[model samples]
Target: MASFRKRGCTCEKKKCTCGAKWEYRIKYVDRQTGKTKEKSKGGFTSKKEAQLAAAEEELKINQFGFAENGNEVVLNYFSEWLEVFKKPNVKPITYSVQERNVRLNILPRWGKYRLKDITRTEYQKWINELRDHYSEGTVRRIHSIFSSAIHDAVHEFHIIRENPIQKIKIPKDVENTNRVQYFSKEQLEKFLNSLKTPQKNAKYKHSIQYYVLFSLMARTGIRIGEALALTWDDFNEKEKSISITKTLVYPLNSTPYISTPKSLKSVRIVKLDEQTVKLLKKHKINQNEVILRYKNYKASKDNVMFHQHDGRWLRTNVVREYFKEVCKRTDLPVLSPHALRHSHAVHLLEAGANIKYVSERLGHASTKVTADTYLHITEKIENEALELYSQYIKF
Candidate 1:
């Protein structure tokens, strides 16, 4: 609560302009610290002006924890939000995305507005304007970052009652969002064959590294980062299971680092078949032979399964470019490295594999994610399961 008080002079050295001196004084408990404090400001022309100022002061203190009279600007608060909330707690890659999104998208649109001034109607209009300029996915990402920051501003800073963004509907064009494509068995084989076949002016006699990398992606439906992160130690030849605990994150122009896999579900032991084990064993033997051919080139102790010529960890971009060249050589469908993973999922589902087991094998956080991704295969698999179940139920 706040009150208007008359700032009467002491009648000593200062002039006795008691009638002209009125001050707004607020005595309130700090919401965060739970401590009592008093704030006062003098030089108001009259008691009525002081009273109005005192009321505004009281409202600010009670609601948004405003100590003085200024509103927080969006850019200033977002920077503070990152330093206080995002930077300290989030993963490096996660922070990188947050920082980049804010700098590129959110800052341009909403940064100039004060927190209190950006209303739901104007923000909604801004979002609708984005659909024509940006894809649904990009717009959704921009909104997600903005909404998350506003969430913090309310909870941590007490800047607003609720996130106004929560009331807005996200523009989700389902057809645009789900563009993941996969290849058939024949197409995949043709793509793989193109890799092993010798190309003009290539330094290596055969594409052993490219073949192994693509095979790994096909066999295990793991993300490229997870596959690249594999070490010799991760594969248990005896058990035929590989431990997937880490992922290689090679951000553009930044030093590569290892991070915990995409999610808790991704940190799993994925079983490998005997044929794959044999292929891997062959690749390792060939890799070592290549290393020995170089002058004084002892095989690197890094133990990374897929490596560069010097046995260092391979960058993802190098692998992507290599894959692109291999695709150009073949008549098979031109697909990204990630298409190998999608192909694995689609093939398993088409072959009457259980959705639950497939979900676990693919390291999906939930079966719903697997079902959602491979929606085309759901009914066919379910029908196959029903027929198989009928044979067992002898009633």
Candidate 2:
């Protein structure tokens, strides 16, 4: 496996630390390049350390059929790995994000360090520096990319024995700093009523279709993407349930495409209130009239519930921009369209819907996620519970 022997040096030279030292050497064949080379290490204080190092190296070589690039600089190696290994295996959206992080953030900062030389302390300092400048979520994402790269180096390339990125202590407060806002019942009614009755000067273009689109998200807590992916086929009129099996994703410069909902639970059936069902009925009749202009496009074939009046898929930004205008007109706090889903969760949970059912309605993979996200509502519910308990205390 590995060879270890005593290496002799002339003690006559004043610069020499010792007359002899432990030496280890091995021959390793390159798996990808198809070449063989001698790998050697020297200058250990004891033979045991030298032998152990050599043994580890030998094991790495044997397992992977090549010598680990432990000596390679971190940047050059990871850049190549990202392009060659990671990009092809992951989805386009994932590849685009990871590639940007690697190229711009990770490599720019740690590209010079050698793989084996990156210590836990060194990474901790780097992370601390990152925390001061970037948001907590961005810093965590960069750390995840670095950790995944090191994990691959260990399992696939046998380059490092451990992942230094994982050992860094993460700041707890640095998680999810996104500003979340939702409407109270009065505010929601005001906003939706503003959409239906536009002021004379503003001339809001909201129709039955936009009204149904926004109402459905508030009613069912479905993501905008999931709502956009719906078709006439997905709605069960008799059962009054909507099938949420797919989502629409539109990346820039690419044709719009339908993909499965984010998780298995995302593909579910959600019952609709009668008012919402009636709204859909009126919207469907209006949509049928609009689709007649597009001779080549089948509205049902396109599988879009809220297809644009011009027979095109509605991009995410289009809906967001329209909602922004509606917010300005309504004299309401400006919130993204996704806030409707959050409002839905908060409203459902406050009305004493079971937590598990709310989780399923939101298509969250777990109730824990639902509980954590709508924690404000849970706190209110806790206070209400205490009031109910007080009724029994007057014995």
Task: For candidate 1, write residues 1-395 as lDDT tens digits.
Answer: 66776666555544455455788878887543467879898988887888888887677556555322225677776776776668989888888888888988788887877787778888898898888788887888888889988886777556666677677876777573564678899988888877776667866654377788899889889899998899999989999888899999988788889999888999998998888888888888878877766554446567988877766688899888877777777865566888898999999888877889899998999999999988767866777779889989968
Candidate 1: Cα lDDT at 138: 81
Give all TM-scores, in the order shown.
0.78, 0.76
Candidate 2: worst 10 consecutive residues by lDDT? 198-207
| Each prediction's RMSD to truth | 8.1, 7.6
As a TM-score, model 2 comes out at 0.76
Clash pairs detected, candidate 2: none
How well is each residue in 1-395 modelled by candidate 2, as lDDT tens digits? 56887678656765566658888988777654567778899988677999899988787666545336576677667766777778878766677789888888888877887788888888888888888888777888988888888888887786777776676776645444433579988888887776666456642233456778888888888999899888888999899989999888887667778887888889899999999888888888867665553454346556567876555778888899989889887888889999899999888888899999999999999999887887767878988989899886866
After TM-score superposition, the amount by which residue 316's alpha carbon in candidate 1 deviates from its true location, in angstroms, is 1.4
Positional deviation of residue 273's Cα in model 2 after best superposition, in angstroms: 0.6
True lDDT of residue 257, candidate 2: 80
lDDT of 1 at 125: 89
